[model samples]
Target: MQSNHDGKKPGLPEIVEILAVSVCFTYISGGEAVGAVGLLIAYATLRWGRS
Candidate 1:
């Protein structure tokens, strides 16, 4: 069986989850600050780790 790894280096579904969470949090937070920060981090990670 292929072992599933859920580490810091997450996969596609994990990234999608993060994005969804970020969107929801940003929506609830009611400001650009939290959303912007979350989005920036996500984008940076996606870009830097584009393997």
Candidate 2:
């Protein structure tokens, strides 16, 4: 955001654009789902780590 601006404070439009982009990115990437999957994989590995 700060870098997006040319050293000037961003107004409402800039803020909205940034938020919209972030929301879209999170949605497209499945956001917290990836984190949950990673945690599950880690737990399974640790629990069945004898292999």
Task: Judging by TM-score against the true structure, name the best candidate.
Answer: 1
> Which pairs of residues collide in candidate 1?
none
The sequence of per-residue lDDT tens digits that candidate 2 reaches over residues 1-51 is 134534455567756755565555557657865655555455434533423
**Total clashing pairs in model 2:** 0
Please, what is the whole-model Cα lDDT of each candidate in the order they appear? Answer: 0.64, 0.54
lDDT of 1 by residue, 1-51 (tens): 433553357678767876776776677668576676777577656754543
| Alpha-carbon deviation at 18 in model 1, angstroms | 0.3
Candidate 1: Cα lDDT at 47: 53
| TM-score of structure candidate 2 | 0.46
**Residue 6 alpha-carbon offset, candidate 1, angstroms:** 5.0
Q: For model 2, what is the C-alpha lDDT against the true structure?
A: 0.54
**TM-scores of all predicted structures:** 0.50, 0.46
